[model samples]
Target chain A: MGTVTGKVLPQPTRDEIRVETVLQALADPVRLRMVAELANSAEPIPCGHFDVEVGKSTVTHHVRTLREAGVIEVRQVGTARASTLRKDDLDARFPGLLTGVLSGVD
Target chain B: MGTVTGKVLPQPTRDEIRVETVLQALADPVRLRMVAELANSAEPIPCGHFDVEVGKSTVTHHVRTLREAGVIEVRQVGTARASTLRKDDLDARFPGLLTGVLSGVD
Candidate 1:
């Protein structure tokens, strides 16, 4: 039996990045760590590289939340998915919000 | 019968303003409205002046959340409390975070 793969979606529209959604996405420690890791990285990171201790499903959910909040951008490279911080979009939407938050985690 | 008023508390410490608490506080529409109003006001506004449509207790809860998030500062004046946006603290903590959020609502 073959497993089905889901399609990779486009980035969320600005209207979709509501305050509630963004807040909810950043509320979790695991997600915050993921975000911080992404911020510190100079290039896109493969989803498989995150050392998150949560279940795979939970990690997927957190990544989806971050993507939906316009905090990260995801792209497909063959079978692997690469995620990059959408620092520009976040800066446009919330100004220095991400920088401050990233600093707080240090 | 005289009402026994609970003492107004001091501001939350810097360590207390976790991402979760701040996100949770700003997640609600009512609280966002209150923060917007405070941001626009040139001076501290009395808590009684908020035109929120929710029940008084609910409004109080929302205000408390904002206060605890370090998004707003509350000072008692006579029998009423005045709430002001803690723009500097927010800015210091999150850089352009508040400005971006405030502009997004416009």
Candidate 2:
């Protein structure tokens, strides 16, 4: 468990990030789109800023999945949670994976 | 469905391959290992030749999943089934995805 801006958001560490788990998280369409958006962004994106059309709970579920999979990090930013793709850590663990998946996103 | 040495094997075309589905197929450890082995091999490998320690039925299940997801193409080679990674088609569709995943495989 880690805290960001006083809120706790549990996520896997660099070594805990498994390739199978990362792939499983990205296997969902909505989550993949959210990751893609985060990948293209220059800064942490508020959860509401994602382009997914799902309900609030669904969005929360997807975000949690991504964070737990170590594909992204979520932190409390002001009144909302912001997410950023864990590109550096992921690249270090699985070189070329994030870039390839992001580029392959349709 | 297409014929391979007189046996029918079904697979998705280049345009039919989806990133999410491909990721889902590769999400399992067993299936991912099979794919990595295929990536390292220069020729089609017999199904029984894979290094997985699973049962025959389980291996068949995993192989079917990969074949259905368009990750590998299984064909009849003599009395046994031989599998090959669909590298060219996957590369054409998803660019560096297969390479990245295979390289990242532990």
Candidate 3:
């Protein structure tokens, strides 16, 4: 809604990421897939790049949840928001949590 | 409600344990602490053994959620149901997930 330029959206700082919140975000199957795909990607992926079969608005909601929970970071890239997993930050905070989750992310 | 002897509760089998379900069950602060306490203990703990501040019914609900998610095993111990983390089964199914979550538990 702001300028058309790239905007780094609000996300929880590493220290603000809570275990309960992160787990809550990942509790949904669709969101889990989104995180799994992001983990497999070598680069930031636009919102539509996730393989989830949900509608656009639902995808947006899932993305927002993940962002708010500090599981991922989104940066506006042109007209689309590109999301990147906060792997480094998560690893630093919870050690092997993401890896463990990803291991079971099928 | 069943017999007072030792009625094992209905729970998902090891192969049926889903990542999303596990995350959902652990997403709550009280449940997470319950798991943390169970993880640290050497013996199965009665529902009353957990340090959660919730009332009796709430504690029962949380324990049932964990048991249903296959994160913990509940067995009738005298008049109480003692719960033990399904560590071995969860490890076989999701690898380091429990360890990672436990690492972050408060």
Better of 1 and 3 by TM-score: 3
Model 1 misplaced regions, further than 4 Å: A1-8, A14-16, B1-8, B14-16
| lDDT score for residue B83 of model 2 | 92
What lDDT tens digits, residue by residue, belong to model 1 across residues B1-106?
2232335557786656665566567767778788889888787777778878888788778778888888888877677777888787777776666776676554
Which residue pairs clash in candidate 1? Answer: A96-B96
Tens digits of per-residue lDDT, candidate 2, B1-106, equal 2334646488888788888888999988888999999888887878788999999899989989999888888887678988989999988887777776776677
Q: Between prediction 1 and prediction 2, which has the larger TM-score?
A: 2
Give the winner by DockQ: 3
TM for every model, in the order presented, reads 0.82, 0.85, 0.88
Which stretch of 10 consecutive residues in model 3 chain A shows the poorest summed lDDT? A1-10
Which residue pairs collide in model 3, if any? none
Error of 1 at B50 (Å): 2.1
Give me candidate 1's TM-score against the actual structure. Answer: 0.82
Of candidates 2 and 1, the better by lDDT: 2
* Complex DockQ, candidate 2: 0.61
Counted clashes in each candidate structure: 1, 0, 0
Candidate 1 lDDT by residue in tens digits, A1-105: 122243455878765666656766776788888999998888677776887898878878887888877778787767777788878777777776777677667
Residue pairs whose backbone atoms clash in candidate 2:
none
